[model samples]
Target: MVNSDSPTTPLDSPLARKNPLTMENFHKFEKASNGTTDSMTAPSATISSTSFNSASLECASKETSTIQNETLKKRRNSAGHKKDYNQTLFENIDYLGCSKLNDPSNEPEMLDLMRVLDEQRMTSAVTVSLAVPHSARGFVVLRDTTGIELTSFPVQRIRFCVRGRLDSAQKHCFSISFTHHGINGEQTHQCHVFRSAQPEMAGRALYCFSQAFSNSGKENMSDNEKRIDYKFEAYLEIRENEGSQSSPHWVLCPQQNNTLKLRRDRQKRLIVQLKQVQLCKVFGPPLTVTKCFGMLLAAGRNLRHSDMQLLELESMGPGANPSVYVINAIWDPRIHVFDVLNTETPRDSRVFLTVAADVIIAEAGEPIRFRLEAKARVFHRDERFYKLPRVALREGYSLTLEV
Candidate 1:
């Protein structure tokens, strides 16, 4: 790198012609000058012929200093902008559901139905839940504030891009473009721009959506690693909705499959008795009983323990059996207990889960035991996973996501 603070030699000067202007030659010049310009001011009789033009040297020195000052100012501004960009991104971490399946943070992480600005058309405000089954794709269910299901669809494709400023009133912004496939085989294209009080939240959401496109089983797995299998037992209970004062809560049961069949209380909640969970290693998606049930179960458990707070699942399409609703969990809030948010990365490093399955009530009173297994390889929350995007030129300055 060039040091603009250093003086430059005149092109016609003998010193500039005799030696290359490398750091070593520059240091020699400094040493020969006795580390001071005092000699340049000495009487002409005392001045040596070996010295170059003193007037030219002084001009060059002034010019160098001015350049150095400008460079320093640019660097400072760039740093400030980068800091704001990162802050904007992390401020919305909870809304994006960026938690890894094995994360352990307990901070409430939920996607605020009101905060999402869908600009294509305005409809009555409704709450929505997102989920990811073993397929690793998005499954979204929209509901009213009262929790009545409105509509559900799968996100087929998504594109994330940065936009340029068009006028003095505009700034560089991030955008998310996605296509949602409805139950009737219809597709809807949606685009949302994030440049509000907290734009990083939109970026975080984009990162999570992109994870669905990554290789399902190969993205996290390294070659030569052996798959491990394990099992455990747990119980489930339905907390019936009573009244506004009675908040629903889960009831823990003891003993795995103790002849406790699945039953629904007055609120239409199904309580299951699951036990003897085991791990399974396979190549296909985890939507079936034999494939990725273990991974899906692990993800569900992780949601409770991780940093994410919102939960959603895929619902049956119109005219489908309302009696048996196939609920497939998608982008739920989860925290990676083993790691903290990679706020330093140029782009946020949120883990996307690849396993998904249906919450089906096959038999009212069947014994439930989950075999803990992952269809995809376990993802390591290490430094190598961090991502850094390239800087882009905007107006007069360059914008970068990293410092």
Candidate 2:
């Protein structure tokens, strides 16, 4: 009521008191201050965002550094484990100890010990005394455990000396027998006497001595001869065969004896001499023979030496090959007579005779005939006879007998 009665005061009125320009200035000032405050706060907010992004980057960098340190530590540990394995592998290898024992730097000491051992082991003493009027050659007697005895003929003059030891002391009581084969094929007489020990005892002693000799360098004669003046050895291999009723046999001096001595029951011995006997021969203009059924015969009617103008002879046993028979005879137009000479026979004379062809006869229509000229020569001719049978001659030919 007071405002309505008082004048229309502009300050009191709501519409009159508000100046448009002042209000507009106030609104503009308020907007400008608000804009300035917002600008200042926006910068602070951007600083906070930048600070948060920098903190995140620092955390990432710290994590990466820790991972790198762990990776580097792991790489260093793997290299140390491999070096310790190789040091323990090669510990025991000795090459120097083996070479020193094999060398013969002390051969004399070894020989002395061997001699002492040999004398102590002798079971008996054997002596042989022989008296000769002239210089005699040396001989060897081979004996074995089975009572096998072999006597070798006197060889050419050989320089040798006797060595013996008894009870650890060198003894000179042993003797050797001697014989001489005169140079002149004349009859020679000499009485050489030697004292011999008991047969069984001497055999045992000799066996022991032979063993010592074999052990002391005689095992390799070729190498031992260079250092020592004498080397003698003997070896006995006693093989028990199921079929043998007696003691083991001995094969002594294979080259010299070329025989096998088999012990049989009742002190009997079987001497199997490796003697070769001639088997056969074929001859015409040339000689040719077939080795069939351990027998010698012409291969065929047309397989004559005259047909091929060549001679071939073969062994009937294992590894049979054709061989040429050499003859000492002149070939004549009338008759090619071959003189069966000693030179024509093999030097060994051990071949078994199966067949022989002295001459070959051939006609156009008649069967060929091979004639025997001589008896087959063989080793131990006194023990065996190889006579050509009359039936062995061809149909029309006859054999000329030679006494």
Candidate 3:
């Protein structure tokens, strides 16, 4: 047991009086300077008091001043979080998304995509990681699962071929063929393919990338830079004869029979041409022609599936029937024909014609005119066209339009 009435140490003497480390006294310099005058305010325990060292008191005062300065700084910056200067550039921005293919049997690679809108251009960057083995001579293998060569560019001079299709193996995938220019003026082409689970998002991705690329060069240009402001409009009227009120008539031009010849050029490329028409309507045969409201054009390379070709064309609402229909042309693999089918059922009509032929569009007139042979076949959904009769024509064909 300890004695209750013993003399205290120097630490106990300081605790009996006011503590100098308290924030009230530490906040004011005058309280520490006038310590002798304020000593009377302290507890009257001088009978058993021990003196504190002058050097220790001075060191304590310096530490209190340093802590107070830090507290003042904290109060001044209470608005928001401070930016981290130690972080890298990529870490500073928000990461958008990435696309990768990791089949061990195939060429394994990953593509990290990043996008940002700057004052001048919309910038897109891709970081690629390849898992190819290096040879004894220190050359990395550059091959892909699809047997296409894979190459890359450091920063600039990258020309890309971006394609979005719903009928790909991954269903809604982007095939980006990147052409990288070498330092010696030689070009190397590499392809990176990625698929998105959200199929419609593939089109959105292409739109964003196109918008960014278009704005890259003309950031500083003004709207007033245009040299001309041109505008014009026109109308047309098709007149009918007095005796032809009971039956429907072919608008603008009459129906006539024509032939399509499919042949190959010297390079073995497909060349599809149509035979000329007489441009007259005859009344004897009572030829059945349904007024088709719209036409869709599509193209495909794979012939395994019948509906795969339709995936190439984005849906266009029913068009005005027999009006001159125009379709955009595709550059790759080249398209030769456009098929016009009667999607309507017999509950709607009977013996409707399905035409497959090449059309020459005349855009110079008031209303457009699609010039082609009027000959077409009566299509049946249940009936297979494994063979064509002497008078019957082939059915079901379309082509994809170019961007």
Candidate 4:
């Protein structure tokens, strides 16, 4: 139950086991002689050094392998029976609203969790409750059926996902992880492991958390500010008048497998990506105009650069592919602007977090100007123009960009 992104690798915990001949010590350590000798070159025991070393290696290998096999077997068999701290944490939570695992055995242990939270809540006024968007507040349970109140945290603080698959693998168990912020601002990560066979319960619990997060999005804008959602429809409307004789184009490199393909839609598109673009961060600053839609998603915006954990997932699409619209991107090779190169990613283990950006032609309010300010004058003024839509900016909203 250590507070960390990844816990002990699955089935690696030191649990009680039934071994036939229990040695005084479960592990063997080969020590170097009383000097600076190599660890492998242990003192010659009885026979030739070479024979003795080989025998030791074989014996050690057998011992370690046997232990690993038995440990894994025991852990897999006692899935729901291990009543460790993680199990207690999982069994006691009042997720979103409803109780998660209301086992009778949990009645006694709930006191410890509540006492710890009560102490923390008394630390200072700030510690009384989690500071999240207004929609996600007041989730703590001071008293419950278990005769003890459970500590609550905003659903926005969690990074999690559930299996959308309808297979045996959907065990109604998903991981809930969060970084515990200590009293003095220290950080410790924790991921709760689910062992109970409550597939339906687990799915519903995850849904509640995700739904709460979905409602408390980043677009919680102020009275004067505006948030815009973009739909990149222009991807399908590159060229409508061209006939069937004109085919899509491809630019392939001579040796490498790198290739770029472009396709045009037969209908008209009102919005597409603009060649002039800027990159913005989620937690860094305030933006005057449209924020990356990913900033509005909990998992996307909460992912910290310092965190190393990754959630491996497969897209539910036919081939788990990136969006087909990326093929319609217009990039300037001369300026090093590039498009997303859709490649064959049969197995990528890195967590695939996305921030969906839409291209919009901002037609009003000074055209959202941007430029490079440099002491060294530009050698070439390679300026480019963007043809924005004819529509005027909304009456109360303004388009803005940061460079």
Candidate 5:
């Protein structure tokens, strides 16, 4: 038996140094002892050992790097996470019909119509009664000054009586005229009244009569003309010759120039009235209508429970300065002086205006003087003017202008 452990020669010293060595000197000895004269010529064995050392070092470095990155990622995620209880509550709760929450102040208010009217005149009265039905069939009667019977000439004496269902959803209309008719051997003119949506009152009904006419030429009648013309004169009694009926008749007359009036009689009701107006200038130019109108610059603040009115605007470009138009505005009490430019950013930019602020206008046209200072700052003031079309919106109240 050979004693492999015993150091018999100097060549065995190299083998002993290579075995069970520390990591620092292992690479040094492995490189030094490789491809030597006294050592074995095992090139494949040397290559395998070198490759294993390099691979082990690479794996260890990568593992250390992964561990450090995981630790950093956890720290970052934890630091960024914050529990917002308000946001969480909003998310958890369902708000299907939550429009009232956004604008609680705009709720409709009850209104009393009779309280606004003055009923002072009771003597020498004109009593007009209108029987209106839910199914759109109705009639209006105008009593005479003595309140005895329907007038002989109802159309000439009585004005129009417009009656409809008290409810806001119904539609009704009425009209009347006079036409000539022959009864028995006498020729006379009769009145006709037309009612809409009522089959019973859809046709023309008798209303009044016309007067008589006399022939001017009778001496120039020849024998042929005498056979055809018998010089007959017929007089139409304007007041008499009428048939009485129990059914109610609607009295209509020519409307006076400015005597008609409208009365609103319900709570939370909407009334639309039309009036004729003569105007020289009409719609103002919209921002989209003309691009060369130029730019509008505005600065103002928005406060809670208040309207931000734009006072002044600086218009730029040639000719007359364009008007400043308000596009859209809202008040946020939490944010102050928020940059109007970057309001849609992901992170909240605390840009808002303080209470009671005025904007400076630096161009021509009418100098804007605002009443409310708390209104939200208008972006496109000219656009606002364009949106609310009609000259009435631009100028307050009503007046007759002749042009």
Candidate 6:
């Protein structure tokens, strides 16, 4: 056998151009192979058992080496494989993009909701209740206000392309689009847009809350990781109805203007209330709501105790069943913001919810509209609501209905 590590002169090498394949070299190689074959096929019976054992061990070692070499080759080939840059990307976060209209002929009767959510009022917090009474279904947008009458139109379809613009002031932008029953027929699709100075504010809060809510599952994580582009999201309820009956308190739809003018005192209180909403979202503990026995149970996102003012799952009301007479609105003004507990993610997080107050209940299989009085966030406050959609459990919410 030749020593692989030993250096050989070009003249003596078999691969040398000077020594190309020749009859002599071929004969020598053929003889060597024949000898090896004969040796393998016929064993020497006269040899001692010790020699036989040694031969068997040598053969075993060669087989193992071949297997090791084959495995190494496989690993090396795998390492050289190219990555697929064109692979589809899956989104783990909620829809944080703005919706673009394909056609505007069909429009949603949206409220000049932004009139109430001005720059000064953004500071005030509104308490939101879900599954309430006598309400309409529509989404609100928190964009830079036009400083005039609100713009409302029926929507056809919503596409996922978050194209945003900042005015000369360079503020973030946002909007609201939802799926609802068309004013005309089954083929008709409509959405509503609201007027505001800070459109993206609501979405930002919702996204922030989603991150925190999902992270809550992994207890004891560092807070530093949570700080991304999000500001905050906490609570809010919204919906559309009866041509959205009793929507005047919060939204200013086109037809309602002649009959319903916003009261000065109500707007003033809302400003203050919206400001308090900011406080609760930042300093207050997270409200973790669970679904058990056809009811949403509220608790801290974590297992730890939390501040009062907000009710626990054992105590959170607007409960599985509420008084129909008083609790009959998507955004009922009768309930105080504080008593309602949550607000639209006024710079608050929504975790697993959307800005379209009406869309939320419908997709949740509840089919109800939620209205906000002051807590920038708005949600319905009733348990047994209209349309009665199949309660869709999403985000991290459990589908299991515990008895």
The best candidate in terms of lDDT: 1
- Give the alpha carbon lDDT tens digit for every residue of 223-304 in model 3: 3332222111111111122123355341221122332112111011111122122233321111112222222222222223
What candidate 4 gets wrong by more than 4 Å, as runs, is 1-134, 138-147, 161-170, 183-186, 194-198, 217-403
Question: 161-197, model 2: which lDDT tens digit per residue?
Answer: 1223233232322212111222332211111111123
TM-score of candidate 5 on Cα atoms, chains taken together = 0.16
Model 3 residue 140 CA deviation (Å) reads: 24
**Model 2: ten consecutive residues of lowest lDDT:** 55-64
For model 4, give the 10-residue run with minimal summed lDDT.
54-63
Between prediction 1 and prediction 3, the one with superior lDDT is: 1
lDDT of each: 0.25, 0.21, 0.23, 0.24, 0.19, 0.22
lDDT of 6 by residue, 43-107 (tens): 01111122122111000000111111112223234433222111111111112111112221211
For every model shown, what is its TM-score relative to the native structure?
Answer: 0.21, 0.13, 0.18, 0.22, 0.16, 0.15
- Model 6 alpha-carbon drift over 4 Å, by segment: 1-163, 167-172, 181-185, 194-203, 206-403
lDDT of residue 377 for candidate 6 = 30
User: Which wins on lDDT, candidate 4 or candidate 5?
Assistant: 4
**lDDT of prediction 3:** 0.23
The better-scoring model by lDDT among 3 and 4 is 4
lDDT of 1 by residue, 285-372 (tens): 1222221121133322234423333233323221242221222232211234222211122222222222223233222123232322
Deviation (Å) of 8 in candidate 4 = 5.9
How many residue pairs collide in each prediction? 36, 26, 7, 3, 20, 83
* Candidate 5, run of 10 with poorest lDDT: 55-64
Relative to the true structure, candidate 1 has a C-alpha RMSD (angstroms) of 32.0
Query: Sorted by lDDT, highest first, which candidate order results?
Result: 1, 4, 3, 6, 2, 5
Alpha-carbon shift of residue 292 in model 2 (angstroms): 24
Q: Residue by residue across 1-403, what tens digits does model 4's lDDT show?
A: 2112333321121211221111111111101011111111111111112211111100010011111112322323544322111101234322211111122112111222222222332221110111122222213122234443223333333433332122434243333443333334344333332322455554544444433444432333342223332221211112222223256342211111111111222221111222221233322232223311211111122444332122112111111222322212222212211111121222222122222222222333332321111010011112221342322111112244333
Best by TM-score: 4
